[model samples]
Target chain A: MNTVSTSPYLAGLLQGQPPASPLTWLNELRANAVDRVGALTVPTTRDEDWRFTDISPLTKLSFQPAQGAAQLAPAAIEQWAIPEAAARLVFVDGIYAPGHSFNRAGLTVENLASGVSRHGAAVQAHLGRYADFERNVFTAVNTAFLHDGALILVPRDTALAAPVHLLFIATRKHAASYPRCLIVAESGSAVTVVEDYVALQSEAYFTSAVTELALTGNAEVHHVRVQREGAEAFHFANCAVSLAQASRYHSVSIALGGRISRHNLAALLAAEGAECRLDGLALIGGQQLADSHTLIDHASPRGSSRQLHKCIVDGAARAVFNGNIMVRPGAQRTDSSQSSRNLLLSARARVDTKPQLEIFADDVKCAHGATVGQLDVDEVFYLKSRGLSDTAARNLLTYAFGAEVIERIPVASLRNRLEQTVMERTHAAAPGAEGKP
Target chain B: MIYQDSKTLLSVRDLHASVSGTRILKGMNLTVKSGEVHAIMGPNGSGKSTFAKVLAGHPSYEVSGGEIEFEGRNLLELAAEARARAGVFLGFQYPIEIPGVANSQFLRLAYNTVQAGRGEDELDPLEFDDFVREKMKLLEMNPDFLDRSVNEGFSGGEKKRNEILQMALLEPRLAILDETDSGLDIDALRIVAGGVNQLANKDNAIVLVTHYQRLLNYIVPDYVHVMDAGRIVKTGGKELALELEERGYDWVGAEAKANARVNA
Candidate 1:
């Protein structure tokens, strides 16, 4: 394999790394990731995996690693606080902010820096194992700088009544932040986790995040990820999930910000009778671009998976969705269905959607469908005939298109906040507001 | 009932319209006065539904040549929503299914929009809920429908009732019902027609565009006009609907053609 040439852009991003961790395995993991980053180059349109999403804008600008955590007041982040969260961990610029965080769940929910010292074996066994960075430059870069992250471990047969919130806030421009998260749900345990990313300013920045989730036998994990970066930010995230026997994983990811953002999620049903449900929504406007790639691997018998992804693009924006479902040769009775629905609100808006299925097992059932369209003319006229203006009708339909996916989010307060945000974004991108009749 | 002294609500003169460059309405002319119900009967492609859509200013239909005056103003200048706000309502033949938008929310918006247009007080959600629940009783709609998406997964009868429910909420000065009886059972037809009858008054007019006389039996019309090809070809009283229903529409088309040849 050719592992010699690394682009100057990748070299520039590898500038300021934190000192080596005291843990030997952790340091070794970082060293391997740095070598991998040196081997992989930035992906371009020529790459089959990134044929539609061009990240040249991210490589055009140079970003430095964040120096220190920003001192933030608890009141500043009060708006994003979840009342139903049993524990909360706040990270500013990829560094844990102890002043704005609290842990009351009596579980192992803390910063990875300290959690590693306490639970080194569990962290070492699962950290760099699931999210493989052999060919993924973004994931390699994230792993190379994975010093601070959120770590949660649910004990066996324990069920938490409330969710755990992991909030990452970006407060500086021209700064590169690698946000990492690793959650381990033991056998028969149940937990909900929210990995949220938000920005305080509208300036160019870079965020490469990697998250790994491991569900043990009969364990249930509800993952809700929200990426609300600034309008001029670049965000790339990789999430890997492994489901054991009879485990259930439900994930809902919403992308509403970032000038260019891409999220890659891979879920492996490694044991029999495992189930997963993946729901996603991207509501973008004003020249923004969002891409989502997901892979569901049915490695064992009786594994079932369902996925529904939607995108509402307006004002010259573009959205892309690629979903892949694979049923292995010996995986009998592996049922899977996936749908990618996109709505273009303006004439210049565009969407690239593909829902693919690869089934090798004769007894497996798999179905996939993709649709890219604009607001239905009949639906718009139906609303207008009820005395709603053209703008109101268009905005309402756009909001409804996204609400279907947002409703799947398990948290009530978060769901309400996202619903409100979707409504406001649709109105702001309306033709009437833009002075177009 | 036709009152001679009633004010004229709508006057159309040589209204010509088309869809996708194919003319559907060919020089249609009609005049509607308040406190009167006019039934425009015709075959499937006779432009009855096209007339209703044109009146509502549907974007698909292009008005190539026409003059539409409503309340002594140029009606064609206003948009669909503007026309709706100005007291013109079109009950669609196929009630649209708007998923994710609750029925209560849609009804409240339409009601408040027309209310605002008339410089009247608008009701808040709580007040609107109470007011709309009373109106729903007129159509015998279940209260659970208010929470469901607008017309989504609704039965044929339920969709028809929802359309009439909107008619009750808006209380428009002119309502053109286009084939509203096509997908309804006898019980639903009676309920929908009863709701329409309650909404009628001396200040408003109703136009029923239908293919059958079954709807005319419930909400009787003062004038029944037979339309063929595009324009109205024959005019008579309410009995004309029964006559055409019994004799079929071929005779009327032949008689109109014979008359056209004589005039030529």
Candidate 2:
């Protein structure tokens, strides 16, 4: 535990390490990121976003950077692989697994380590460009550590026919992994990226991830970050997406595992005529906790944004959803709406959801609502009267509660996988169980 | 006491029930036999719906004093699902719409439950699918209807048709059609009644509870019982429904109260 003095040990690991790249341009950004990380601190209950989700587990966990020349066996890779992905990028213990990545042309996919070691120029231009590190301590810490992650660049006017799947697996217990991702969809380009943060081992673990995306002018990007870590693990992530003129951005955040988890997601509709849609679902059980904090900024005129988040909590589990949508002045016709619905499956289960909307533009249409309730009794009785047992009744109602959001995922096989995982957790009243399809 | 015979399918003796401490069904008595259909008709606020709801074991309704025996087994001792498993089906006047449970899924569950209760192995998904498809075709229902949520967006006639479809699947020993024809067009009435007529077998009984006599023209009942002020006051053959439709409920109510006073 003493080895884990700070949130992440990457900064200390690279303190005296020699630069493998010919250029030293990124050194300045690295120093700046470290300074930013040094300045910010983990939040407490006093902070608005950290009000419901407890951060003690994160502060107490022991973390160490992955050592050099550690090989993840092929059998382990095959057992936990995402076969449905068009392209797969594997990161084990926060280090890029060399033989595990499958890259193709018209789409540039590579490990952040290779780009930083060999191609410093391209790495310096985009790293830590889209996130606001100062506002979130976890995001700043990830940037400072930033050892390795997946970097995907979609060339201008090029649209990938399939989804690029990024997988980060936690293979060591009582250890921390920092997986950073940056996706750039160039002008007139279209691409979809699915980032999965999964725990390969059942032992206790902590994973802090940062994913940044930028959609260039007239570009369309769909990004989904699904975290289904093992129980006895602490998961934290920060996702930021920015849209340019006439570009479209859609994101779905699903938090279904981890003993303690929190997600910080922010989207900026900065270009005129751009559209942004954000949806999320969180299924929590056991002593597990999942909290999501989202902010949407409608900065330009005629841009629209919509957000919907649903949460289901059972057992002694707790869930939190805090969403804010801001329509700035002169951002007229910025249609934005946000809503959060929660279902408490047990008397001990709890949910705290808040939807905040700030509309400086009088002409903008912005509305928000939040609801926390148990399963509808009449609905339960109706199903039970039809011969379904009580468990079946509650399970059906809870599945429906989250199905509306899961259905919007647009990935059939992926949605089915998440639905199965959620159903299994629904029965055990705990995270990290297997579900029957 | 009514239907003092072992051949009776459903027997009620001075049945009394209440909701929220307020008694609704006071001394209601009725009986039915296999192969015969009975229609209980009454005016509004006459506790006509209470008898149907009580038999279905609605939690809100308390059975204060009653002996409801279905196939010689005590009905009040069972829960709603138990009563359903015991082969007593209630076609709700206004069926509740369950948003997430799919129509075919709910029907399969109901069918498997009844089958299991009768000591039969539950049909697997493929077998259940085949079974449901055949039943849907028999009722002239579209195959796509099974994919939708249970009556989530069903029309009035569609809801009634769905009820009859369930009846055909479960093959209950006693079917309680609670105002099944209240919200239907003449065409919908014929289709729904046709489905119900096809499902009623000689081994099962049908209790059609309605206010109007029009539905009787399609699925004619063996007997019509006139209920007023929480008790059945008149019992006659099928023609009784037509006579009451013409004479109105006012005369029946006046005659029932007068007869009670004379007996007192």
Candidate 3:
């Protein structure tokens, strides 16, 4: 880790007075966050949590908050939108672009800044409650710039007919944007939210994003985030979720972009019988590096969770996956399983996956495993024997390895879109890098 | 060597091959014309499987010095996929498991590739699904196999049937079966052989590479060739297979040694 990127404070991001807000409480919340950002620094290699990922590039630059939504041609973002989404929100450069967004009935989807403008007490109770900024600096940065993002709330007993797609587009060079999202699913409600991050060009930018999801009793949420930023961009994202009694949460994070990207995913099971499934897939190649750090905390009795995180490394790229499942005291009857499957496509591509289970509850069923491998030679031979070229065979096999985890997503349209993305990318999941056609 | 004709589908002359610096096929020779069924029988380590893989241009074995002609073209110069596109098929003894690619997708890609190579119209997914289902009935393979991954969880017999299914779909001019009947039960053998029999015509040829004569009883061969120490020592009619089965292979090995010494 370089010393410059590891520094704790980055100046000149505040610009001016916090924001023009009617609510003093929200303004005070933002004020406290700026103070927190000044105190908490970027996690360094000495920090056990960030041992494998180096954020030196992030420390060297000072970024200004993106100005406003820029007008892009219609055809650019149309490819990323699925018609199946009931409500679609488009944010260009971390600011909502109304011209490119759509919303359906029976659901409330508004910009975070708009939600704060109305000054409703309901938004006040849920916002910033699930994410903690005492230890994480990125969360504080997002909180300091919390006037914009996607604000969603699902009412009780309403099962959404279609998902809400939040599309975040990063553009411009040497600019920084803090994208925040708050999803509060009321009791007995079911919803799915997709966070899609894309880039139109290979210009360098910084996207410090945070999302807080709170699921009440008997609520269900399926959260999927796709990160496909440009190869030169930087992405730092954190998702903190809390589940109530009998609530279920499932999340799949696909990271496939940026020069240096790290996703911090943590879930808390706070009530009995709450179930969760945490899955992730990262595709890194060239000189890029992506890291996924996950923590699942079981605080109540009879809670269960299952996790499978996988990464495919190609070229000289590197990937890191750290998954920890904790069964706290008095959390009996906890059933959790975690596995990390890493595939190395070249001699230089590498992965560091650590699956840990810290159990304080004596009577619990917990299992964790980790594996790193390459494509099977016999399988490749078989594909080649059937008239497939060497490159096609290797690509097909590499796509399948990622598909094993991606196919777990139940939504057909979402699953198919992701399948297309993985297939279209480079098939560097084979051993040798030289002489590949 | 068998006499070559205008109807010849494959012609092999003085073929030599080795793997990892060790010679496996040394000056082996054979010739097969369309409409003919030839069976090559040999004991362990005689390179019957190696010859089949070499025909399909497997990357493992290098043709040190030899010649292989298929369909009036030099076979060794083509890549494995190019050979498949040019109508050469090899049935592996051990089918590999591909865990996530659907069987139907695999079959269609191969079928369309060969069709494209021949300048024929390619079938779309829906059309290929119907065509593949019809072919599946010949092997009694369940329709569910189309949705599952290729040979991932299939039984040993099912894997062989899949190989034959590919052979049937591609409609290769020369089909080589390497121990396809090694692990099949009696019933499976009849079904698979029956499928093979239906596929044989005057436009293509079939080569059965096997260890036991039991398979020959189902799909009788026109010529039976005895391979020993990487060379064909004897070539006779189909009845020669039964004779070898009865008399065993030691006498044949000894006779070849005696003949070699006499020639020297």
Candidate 4:
């Protein structure tokens, strides 16, 4: 390795890391991640992957790793309770809060620190394996700091009737938290997992999260990730998934908060007849920035993937979507399509959407499109002609645009909560520019 | 249905309008009394649609110089939604499709908004469902339409029928139908025309802007006006539709040009 010193930013973030794990393999994994973090530096706008997103604001601040979990009352988190969730794993400031969590599904759903000791072989086989921390500094940092997180392993031929919710809440200012999750679905098993990131404080904080999912043959997994951090926080996340033969993976991620947030998702279709569907939405306003980058790799024959991402931006906020689909050389009959649509609710609001498709297989079918525009005037007029005011019409249309993705969520209480949040945000963002004659 | 003391519902005086700096309605004038059905017929690009849009206060069209009075109020000063609340409706030739909004929700909101503007109590969803279902039967519409998105994936004729359904719900005093029968089959046309005929009464007036005399045959107009070059050039009774149907619009344009030359 090159003898380059760690940058002051990385050195500052490396402070207050948890002590080494008792498990040797886990300790070795953490040691390798620490070395990778030392080798890599924080990316800038000049980096091709971060050309549109400028994260210098994130580097200017110093953050210490959270030491202990904050004392939160049960009532503080009662509003986020999902009546349909079979289990909930609550993490406060990246530390597991066992007092506020429950699991009734009789599955292996527990904190990673304790889980690694019990499921050591299984955890070592998958943990830090799919998500490549060598090249990515944030993932490396998350891997280096990963000690306690949400761990779920579904047994073979088992199907859970209810979902598992992983709730990560930020409660401190100028503190950095690494939230990690690993889910493995065995052959012929199915599960629904929800990864939720929220905040109890409005002050500036940093959240770096990494999630890995592995689906074996004939396994199915539905993943829903929602990031609603504080207005002054910084959030970055990376999710890597691998699909085996005839396995299916479906994911819907919504970004509605954070001063500066970025989420990177990569799905690898490893074996034949694997399928993946990805849907995302970022509803932001008021100088906030949300960036989403997704990659769907069809590496085997008969693999299919479909993705749709939408953004509704208001005020001076900005949203970015970069989606890439790759059909490998031997991946015949690979079918994939992606659409990126954005709505700018104000003149100052901005959107950057890019859809890329690469197909080496001649018989593969791939289509992609990107659109950034204001609301359709004809649609607004149609609603207005029916006696709705201009403001109401624009708000309704904006809500409808985001609702297309929200409707895909399977959980009823979560879906209703998100619908209410979308409606409130759209209405609150609809006054100044939308009400103009 | 014309009464002895039928009041004037709409009066357009020298309505000059343009869209994107191109003059569309140049000094167009018309007056409609309550209970009268007027047909504004013209060839393509003859300002028939523009006239209907202008009356509805479409934002794209600029009224550089004009005045429109609806029920003795200055309709030009009101916004599109305000005009709708003020009992003015425009049936678009190509109704817009809103993909995510349910049809029942849209219709109920429209109905409640108009009802609230009239100082009447609004009905809840259950009450409105009963009220709207009864109205849908008049147009022979399927109840399943309530569950689908508004006008999304609807056939051309189905969109027109939806427009009439809204008209029936809102009960506007002055209704302008701009090519409402453009894309309908014979059976759809008969059903749609029957719905419009049923909604028309002595308290309201209907204005049909069409290019063909086919729609006029069903919902017969009391007066037929031929428009050309952005202004009406010929005005006659219902028989004029039949005459124009047989002897095409070329003679009318020629006659208008000759008349303009003689007057000049």
Q: Cα RMSD (Å) between model 1 and the true structure?
A: 3.1
Candidate 1 lDDT, tens digit per residue, B85-155? 89999999998887767788788877887787788988888999999999999999999999998898999
Q: Write the per-residue lDDT of candidate 2 for residues A234-325, one digit (tens) a residue.
A: 88888888889989998888888898888888888888988988999998877989999898988999998888898988789999888988
Candidate 3: clashing residue pairs, number: 2
Model 3 over residues B1-264: C-alpha lDDT tens digits?
Answer: 233453878999999999888899998999999888899998989889989989988888899887899878999999888898888888889988766578888889878867877889989999999999999999988999999988888988899999999998999889999998988999889989989988988788889999999999988898999899887888989999999999987778889899989999
Q: Which candidate ranks first by DockQ, i.e. highest?
A: 4
Which 10-residue span in candidate 3 chain A carries the lowest summed lDDT?
A1-10
Please tell me what DockQ candidate 3 reaches: 0.33
DockQ of each: 0.42, 0.39, 0.33, 0.45
| Candidate 4: residue pairs that collide | none
* Order of candidate numbers by TM-score, starting with the best: 4, 1, 2, 3
Compared with the true structure, the alpha-carbon lDDT of candidate 3 equals 0.85
The local lDDT score (0 to 100) that residue B77 gets in candidate 1 is: 97
Chain B TM-score, model 4, reads 0.99
Give the per-residue lDDT of model 4 (tens digit) for B175-231: 999999999999999999999999999999999999999998899999999999899
User: Per-residue error at B10 for model 1, in Å?
Assistant: 2.0
Question: What are the per-residue Cα lDDT tens digits for candidate 4 across A1-437?
Answer: 12232787897788777887788888788778888988898999999999989999998899888887799999999988898999999999898999999999889999998998999999999999999998999999998888889999999999997999999999999989998899999999999999999999999999999999999999999999999999999999999999999999999999998999999999999999999999999999999999999999999999999999999999999999999999999999998989999999889999999899888899988988988999888888877887888888898888889888988898989998998898788888866433211
**lDDT of every model, 2 decimals:** 0.91, 0.79, 0.85, 0.91
Q: List the residue pairs that clash in candidate 1.
A: none
